[model samples]
Target: MPTLKELAKRPERLTPGHRLCAGCGAPIAVRLILAAADKPVVAANATGCLEVSTTIFPYTAWNIPWIHSAFENAAATIAGVESMYRAKRRRGEIDEEIYFVAFGGDGGTYDIGLQALSGALERGHRFLYVCYNNEAYMNTGIQRSSATPLGAWTTTSPVGRVLPGKTQWRKNLTEIVAAHGIPYVAQSVASNWRDLVNKAEKAFHTDGPSFINVLASCNRGWRHEPSETLKVMQLAVECCIWPLYEVENGVYRLTYKPKEKKPVEEWLRVQGRFRHLLAPENRHLVEAFQRYVDEEWEKLLKRCGEA
Candidate 1:
């Protein structure tokens, strides 16, 4: 991994002056991932916050070759592009080695684009697929997605007289992708720059398919102050809600583990989405949330052989 000074010296791939929300983690994650690339890169972005915000009709924030694809075809689009690159290289038409990356939100990744993503991975495309998971469809509206955690409020999963927030736990997309026997798969967060960059470096270096699911905080949808974005994400990691880890060649490894895992409430209390769980009458819901986190963390530890 490059030192902070070394990383700062790399030319910016995702330039500023776009309209991404204040304190949005997506751009930060994108910049970090791109900075770790040692070669030229071509990126495909699914129709989501990153795509719409960064490229408004006449303007674009990307410094490298970029393609704007449909919400569910980022992986497929990048795969096709990569295939073309391979063919061109074989014909001696292209001499430079280039990396391919696809970016999508949770809505495009966990729900709409799952099929395309799955197929791309199964076909062994030499590319990196990054899912900037904000837990909901923030681009369209704050609608719940398969990546949304239980007891989190969203437009589709409202907390009212009928029931609480989202009733089901989030889909473990990282593990699902890893199950495809891909060369590399990881779960990272935007707040931890070093760990995220290290994982991005590995993902880019892998010879086969790689996927990194990064937790990107949505200040608008999450109903938190813009400045609290990193704080919220860091708490999520410390509480074991979003463990930083990677799976390489079917072997799981924990990259950053909290010395003492904090309670889930510490992570939930700051976000309005999970505010209801802190109510006196809803104390049990918090307990349920903790139990789920604990179980999932244990499962991950066991897989990494740390349990």
Candidate 2:
């Protein structure tokens, strides 16, 4: 395995001149995945920040063959594309193998696109589906999504006298995908570039539908300094808020574990969305959230053969 520095040297397939916000994690995620692809690929992108930012009329940021589809149909659209290729190959219309990749945001994957994604996985399509999860509908406005973590403030889930940000915990889409019995399912964050690249490579090579839920932080939505995106993601992982892991052939494994699980306060305090949670009394709520995270991590540990 090459070092992260060496792996990062791989040319980015997502080029410059795109309109993604500074410290936007989506484009960075595309760069890592496509670099690991290491070959020609046809990508279908859903209507989200990536679709809107990368395609502005005549301009596009994608270096590979890409298409923009409806927000809720990216998975189905890609599956259709893959089916077409399979039919062509059967008739000797095209002989070359093409990798199919579908990209979508959390809103698209966990909410609107859930049916399409489930169908795609159930059918066992040979494609890689990536959900660039920023935990909300960030492209339009900071609205809540199913993937939004508990206690995180969003436009729809504002912190108020009665409510503390989003009331529900994050919907575990990775586990949902894993339940379909796919050959591979992984979660990676952009802060760890090497793990992101390696998982992308593994997903690309897998035969059946492979899925990756990538943690992408949005500086604008989170109200953080643009330069702190990586730091925020690192803190998320170190706090056990995001655990990096891979499930191959229905067997779960932990890819990276924090030396000591840091306090969730460290992860929440950096973003304005969670600033309100730092109130003296509210600190206990954050601590409670950490306990939930620790429980979930323990569940994962049992699967990883560490318990």
Candidate 3:
């Protein structure tokens, strides 16, 4: 892993002065992922917060080669570009090596673009696909996506007397990609800079398709203070709601484990989306949420051989 000082010395690939919200975690993930690349990078971004906010008309925050794809198909776009690069390199038309990366929010990734992503992975493209999972369609009015957690309030999954929030659990996108037998797969958070950077470096170096699901907090959608983004992410990790882990060559490894595993309530109480779950009448929902987290964490432990 590159030291913070070393990373700081590298040129920025995603420049400042964009329209991302004050506490949005997507840009932070983008910077760290881009900074970890040792070679030049060409990125394909799905139509979401990162794309719309960063590249608004004639202006753009990207310093490297970048393209904006539609609501879906970022993986397909990058895959085509990677294939072209390979052909050109084979023909001796291009000598310098370059890395390919695709960025998307949960809306594009977990829901809209899943087919394209699966196809790209199945084709064995040499590229990195990152999902900046803020748990909803944050760029599209906070509508619930398949990545949204249970009991989270979104425009589509409003908390009401009939329905608490989302009625179902989120799709396990990381595992879904892993099932494709890709070379690399990981789940990370922006607050854990070192882990995130290290995973990005590994993904960039991997020979085949690599996927990373990063739990990026959306302050506006999550209803938390902009400054509390990192704190909220940290709590999620410590509470095992979003454990940091990686899968390489069919081997699962836990990247970071809380010294003392905290209760899910520690994570829930911090975000307004989950505030309803903490209510006295909805105490059972909290218990149900805790049970889900515990079950998922235990399953991960078994897979990682730590059980």
lDDT of each: 0.94, 0.91, 0.95
Comparing 1 with 2 on lDDT, the higher-scoring candidate is 1
Residue pairs with colliding backbones in model 2 are none
* lDDT per residue (tens digit) for residues 227-268 in model 2: 999999889999888999999998998999899989888888
Report the Cα lDDT for residue 129, model 3: 99
Q: In model 1, what are the clashing residue pairs, if there are any? A: none
How many clashing residue pairs are found in candidate 2? 0
* Model 2 ranges with Cα > 4 A deviation: 1-11
The best-first sequence of candidates by lDDT reads 3, 1, 2
Error of 1 at 91 (Å): 0.7
